[model samples]
Target: MAEQMSRGSQEPIRNRFPTLFEVLSRKTVAPLDLYSFYIYMRDQQRAVDYLDFYLDVSQHLILCRAYVRRLHRSVFEDTPEIEKNSKRSSYILHDAGEGPSGEKGSIADQRLSAFLRSDHGSRAQSPQNSHGSGRSSPAGRERPPRPSFMTLDSPGDSSSPGHASSSENVPRREDLRGSAEKILYTYLLPGSEREIIIPQSILHDVQEAIEGPDQRSDPELFDSAKDYVFQAMERDAFPGFLQSKGLGNLVPQSMMFRLIIGLISVFGAVWASFILILRDKPRTTRCWLILPYTVGIYFIFTHQYMLDPILALLGYSEYTLFDFNRMREPFVIKTLRMRSMSMLLFFLLVTVATCCIFIFVPGKDL
Candidate 1:
């Protein structure tokens, strides 16, 4: 129910975004998940940034779980952006002026981390104001230290461009699950550089919450300005955003909402048609008048999807979700599209049923 009110509603702008006072009121017990954001430039962190290639969220959980499993190797040699010690993930793990031999972690954190560098400067260009001003490009800051030939440990033969073997130099195409998850989490930021991913489940969840006793007015604004520096920059070549959960059932995609809306509309139209039929002065002009003709036509042709164009124009048009189908799988679209063809037939049946119940009953209808 994320305030299902249209854009031109009566609420004020400040009310639209949740306030600190509001969050403490009706917070749920659901665990909060944190995802990192980043921006890359100047030919650096190729492995860390490579997740941009497969930036899809349709089957996110499956992808992330798979990537985590695949990313078993040690972290990359160059990536000192992440802290490597045992106690806990420290916020500032970069070259703390304690020299270049930074702490090293398990082999897993090291795998492709060689490509990452800390975002010591502002990543966002400018915030989008209420006045609709376009996004300003963020000024480039001084570049951080580039990775050297030495590996993560305090010794020779680390994963820098120079000392790496030719085999490791080639990008590890197979185990990119972590990178992909990181990319998706990056885009879920406030004023994200990436386009908004309208995940249906999360959207629906938000809606339900908004409609409940305590609405989550602005879930995106929960993150503070201090944490905002971690904005990850990316572009979606395909731009088909899946659910926030990252993966699940294929049938009820975001488009399914539109389809449900379509079906409800058709039902309303049919209901209105029956009301008109009841109001028709010539009681003999039955509601089922269209049925015998439907049977006759069905014999002439086995099945035809759409209502007649004339009828279609008069609010009987079958909604063809070509725009929606683009996101659904071929099998789903085919199955739904095939079922949709019978809508005309269903309408005829409903119409006939309406007439019989109204006109043929012996006593005055209830």
Candidate 2:
């Protein structure tokens, strides 16, 4: 889709910054890219809560899909056959063991089992049953007959009025609906700790889909929500993200070191300038000052913006200082290191040259 859209446009896609969707959909943008963006939003922008909500919802949807698939397989494919065979075996055993005392014993056992089953069913269907308590039912306990409303053909179909009396499977559907509602209230609804800031129309759409009669989870709703989030970030947050100082927030050590080096270079430049100006010197001696002055000026300009144009002239037209800072490729890092070292070396050499001119070349005196 993105390729087709790019093709339809006059501008080459590569010349433009990629949207958040493009960045996320592409496999090449690793987790580190997202992490760096998260850090920037968290620390610099101070608006990371929406992103947090988006991530949580995304994870929840993935888990819900996996769980639904597993549930579908277990309920439709496995349970009925296993129950039929087990019941048939139990009936045969009871018939074989029928005798005077055995028959009486069997009757007593049936009564007790019926009572236990009824009690377990009531507990399982109770609204008051806690989430953890549902799992404590005995393993060997018989499951109630599969509800008529649930079918192999359409697992997501809503419960039919005819099967309303068979309340056994209703709890499972209710549990799914209730879980989804909980997530909605916790993240998307008003007063949530990390409420997502989306358009009211999108929020309404999400609420309607989740709260609808559909018994099964809706993957389309989640996909739409994710798309809206990506679009919102791309439209609103992306420009700020691009303009922000690259990965400085992510790698504070490197940023601090770079700042310190820049300060040293600026100081060296100023010191060299002052030394040349303060003493009245022959033009021959002053001519040597150009070297230190040039080195100092180069460092000052290239520290931020000037290097970009020079690199553009050298065929790296698309590269910016932001890209340089954010990229962790071996060559990029090596280039940055080399630039820093060169700055330091130039500073040292200029200092030594200034000292030489100060000592060796005598200043004019009356």
Candidate 3:
């Protein structure tokens, strides 16, 4: 049973990682993957408007789906029940020789009717109608008024009569449509404060689909827009993100090891030079020491070049010498590994040769 549960848990992760890897590997990314990249870019201080736009479109699509589902459920399932209840109550009032006006409605029904009527009246009086308002300014684009039915109190609080009554009031279809449109204008419209930066063609396509006479929400409305955003990120943003120094910071252990090796190599070279100079040896014997110094110095220099950031700040012509991104390339990594190994071997051989010359080949007195 535990094994089965573990497999179930792993299933989602296994599906997700492949998509994540594809995005990281410079392959196509989905809308959700784009959001992950957006967060990274935001932290790295890179431009992320494109990803932001994609996220907004995705959210708008979700809201539309929820609106459509609720609308259908109300129209097909709940409306008939409400109508029958009203008719039955009217008949009871008639049998008692009392008009509908004389019958006192339930407290919950009275409050709900009054709230809906007031809300509908306010919407009618407002000058900036949601349907006619096309790309209004941020100040002009107001959020739809929250229905009085929604309260901060928990739904499970059975003690509060207000909460109990409010919970029964379902928002009318028009209110839902207006709220969805308000969200759409606030984020997705071209001139709004939180405007997305999608292409005009995709923007127009979305607008037409949402504002059409049919009023039906189709899932495919945002598909083209999503594909366009993914392509844009893959082409432009993803490459730069992969090459960023922020990405290099992710592997501190490797960088720390390189720094230690570089410092030791430099110190060893300096110490070896001093030792050779202090010895009272013939010029020919001293000349043999150059081989070790050359190998040691070269290794130190390459290491310093790879790790130093000061060179870039100084506007050095060879700024690429210290580029973390360049150093991370597969070919460059392989070349550096081989070169470091070869240099170490060469240094050892030169040290051995120099020592042998000093011992076997007698140096003339200087």
Candidate 4:
């Protein structure tokens, strides 16, 4: 459907940004895929002739959804300190209420300008407060900060108070000079890669637009768009039948680590319980000792509290678990069933071992 729509409706995006589009075409990575769609959307908006055309293609919407996924990854990666620093500051001249004569405008002027901008100005005009809710009014409260996957070198300090404050709070940037030199020496110049820098602020706008699009306003488009997103994820997740061989290998390495921890906890608990059962201790006392271990293990495995510090280092939350939909994937279901079967087999083996010890061993007289 997307290919059909691409035939004659709009010029190929590749023609507009050839080198960058080429990288997008070849790479299935999240960053490049999303950045391409963002550029396409921006170009469509800017081109006066393309005003009648909007992104309606299935593939295009999938890319937009991929953008949302990458943004979530960034959020998961952010540290608490980074989150605090990235939050929108209320230090605008209006919030502080106008400086003296040569300073910022008066409170009345600030309010008046804000009103005018809300009513008539393009969202781009109010970059600091622009939202994608399709409303003219500014957001009541600032949302969490979103950092870009990549950024330019840090800007030098500015003498202006406002610039100083913003610089301090904004997302960090990479030092391109040193990195660029290495790339220039090692490989041919990736012209598109060099030119395709999307700042954290612009990425924020792209995120709002994707996540906050009103379904009721355009039901058909909304549903189709979401479906495309799901399809894209599923396609990437299950690229081939054989490649999807094992359950443990189905998810990323990070998720596999969690699964391993859960399995180990279950086995460890079973062994400990078997040992207690063999002991001559009173049943109530044994139960009390083992019960707390069971509860603690459950919490550690499910909540992943043990993984919190490691997840934080990667800019993700340990408590923020993966989407429930992932667990519903056919491969995931098969894997889980297999694990349960294995557990039953292990339990039977342990029980047999214990029975043999009881039957064959001679007991000492009390």
Candidate 5:
């Protein structure tokens, strides 16, 4: 549905962007897919390479979602009135598809003027945002299409020369990118999508996040997008699967490393107890002798004081409630530094156990 984005240019978006992908069902376009693309772009922070090429080639386009997926690249890349380094501003999306309804150029000028005045500080505005939810646009206005497999269905899928094939299982990157473009063009570009006006400071933080220390880190590309976009990502946290498939696989003998350590301690106590028994000493003291070691090992495994460091080493993101600006906070830094010691300790413990076995066991040679 279309209505006035401003005075006079109430034309439908399809006429302007004129891309068919704009009308596709949304199911084919997953939020995570879009988030990934956002992650890639936002990481660039300021570099949109080949700007004019995209702008010109995509002139007949609406703002596609973040990714480059399908055949439609039609969107009017109208020069935004936002100037360089406008610290405070909000993005206003206008349906370039809709021809100017008001006095020619007035609507675009109005949108630009608002962005310029705000210095990019205010909320990004879109026509959709102004329209209440579930409300239809006035007659003859264009609305975003729901994306679907049927739309992307190629000639191979349908035996129709102009259509898509039916047998493709997974979509390619181009497909994803095209779909993303359409989403952006229709839903996000103009005053259609929710205007997420992030503070410049926050944007800087996001840039810093992806661009690591020494300024080499990949930027957090997803920061500027819908919050729920990545809810489906199963981040590869530990590479534990690799370990489990190989050296890290925990059989019964090594199931819980803690349990293994306890078993070793118990064996030590049992051996010591046997020695006492052979010398005609009481057997009851054996369990008592082993109790401390069992308790100690149990606590160590449960608390994982050592493992935290290791996990951090394996690239865990860190956050803390404590403010450090006022105090030295050396302890906090120190603790963070030592987060990876668990992996080291596991090896060290193994070494210590080996030494003990060689020293204490009868007829054992190391």
Candidate 6:
């Protein structure tokens, strides 16, 4: 029974992210395997950097499943139905009648009616229109008199610029509440039963693994970074936030790693250049020349896609890097496959160049 339950749980994970499952199944895979899993999640041979968009959708679905499970457990827990339905006196649903006693046609109601009739009669008795003093009001030209203490403007009225501007700036409580509801439904509530069966931990593990050892060691670091990102995004646009963070010395972990790699590569390139200039042999010189260019190209081409793993480290949603809607287009998938292939090729070239520069080139010079 335990084995069956484990298999049942694993099945949903396999179906949702087969690449990630396969990568996890491998014992010797690198941390980048997680990033690759997300990239190739939809494709066998290609993974665009933008494929990270599915990560967000997957997270949303996972959150939705959890919400469903929590709601189910909360609803079906041991509790009396009558007690659940009971309300405080303040929360009681009152009748729409005039008062608590259900009384109507009272003196107050009569007085209110009389006041409305008198006000209507006063409005209807206006003689001079707005044009001039002697100009008698035309039929239906009698305008409603403005109240002394207050004014009410129709929502659709365009005549009052100030009123329209002020109303536009006033946030609608219904809109704000409705937006909150829509976000909850879209990201944290399952529309169907299938989503509720899938586990979130597996996906989170994959994302964490790809992020790096730093993030995996301390998940709270990523949480803090995510909170910072969310706050920055709320205050301004994503691009602007990125710029501000950059100017403020808040460098991304991926960029830091890349910078470290770049500095090392620059040293290697300089060493190789010197070796090439001093070396007399043609074959040895060629090997030394290729090293710097290969390393530089590898870093340049892979930097964008590399940001995914970095963001994963920062606890940012993959949707920040890519959109799920693009996942459906065949052209986009093909382009991503091509890019992935190019990056792989560049990586292979860099590896070969490094090996040659260190091993073969030294041997030839000796």
Candidate with best TM-score: 2
Query: Evaluated with lDDT, which candidate comes out highest?
Result: 2
- The candidate, 1 or 3, that scores higher on lDDT is 3
User: Which tens-of-lDDT digit does each residue in 281-333 have in candidate 1?
Assistant: 34565444444434443322212322222222222212132211121122223
lDDT of 6 by residue, 113-212 (tens): 2332332332322213322235644544322211111132222443122222243322221222222222222222345211211235543443343233
Q: What is the lDDT of candidate 2?
A: 0.44
What's the C-alpha lDDT at position 128 in model 5? 40
Candidate 4 lDDT (Cα, whole model)?
Answer: 0.31
RMSD of each: 19.9, 17.5, 15.6, 22.4, 21.0, 23.8
Tell me how far candidate 6 lies from the true structure as C-alpha RMSD in angstroms: 23.8
TM-score of each: 0.24, 0.47, 0.40, 0.22, 0.22, 0.25
Instruction: Give residue 15's lDDT in candidate 5 (0 to 100).
Output: 13
Q: Extract clashing residue pairs from model 4.
A: 76-315, 76-316, 77-315, 77-316
User: Model 2, range 1-366, lDDT digits (tens) per residue?
Assistant: 233223464432332344565444332122124655666567556676656555644434333333333333444454566575565434432332232354553353333333323323322333333222234333322222121111211223333222222344332433433444445665577786557677788778777765543322333454566667767777777666644322112133333444566667657655754575566555566666556455544444444432332332232312222343334322223343455456556656765665555545555443
lDDT of candidates 1 onward, in order: 0.29, 0.44, 0.42, 0.31, 0.30, 0.34
- Backbone clash pairs for candidate 2 read none
Q: Candidate 5: where are CA atoms >4 Å away?
A: 1-225, 229-255, 277-333, 336-366
- For candidate 3, the lDDT comes to 0.42
lDDT of 3 by residue, 220-324 (tens): 455676677678776766655543321222223334455566567546645654555555555565565555455544444434433223322222212122222
Candidate 2 has what TM-score? 0.47
Alpha-carbon deviation at 243 in model 3, angstroms: 8.4
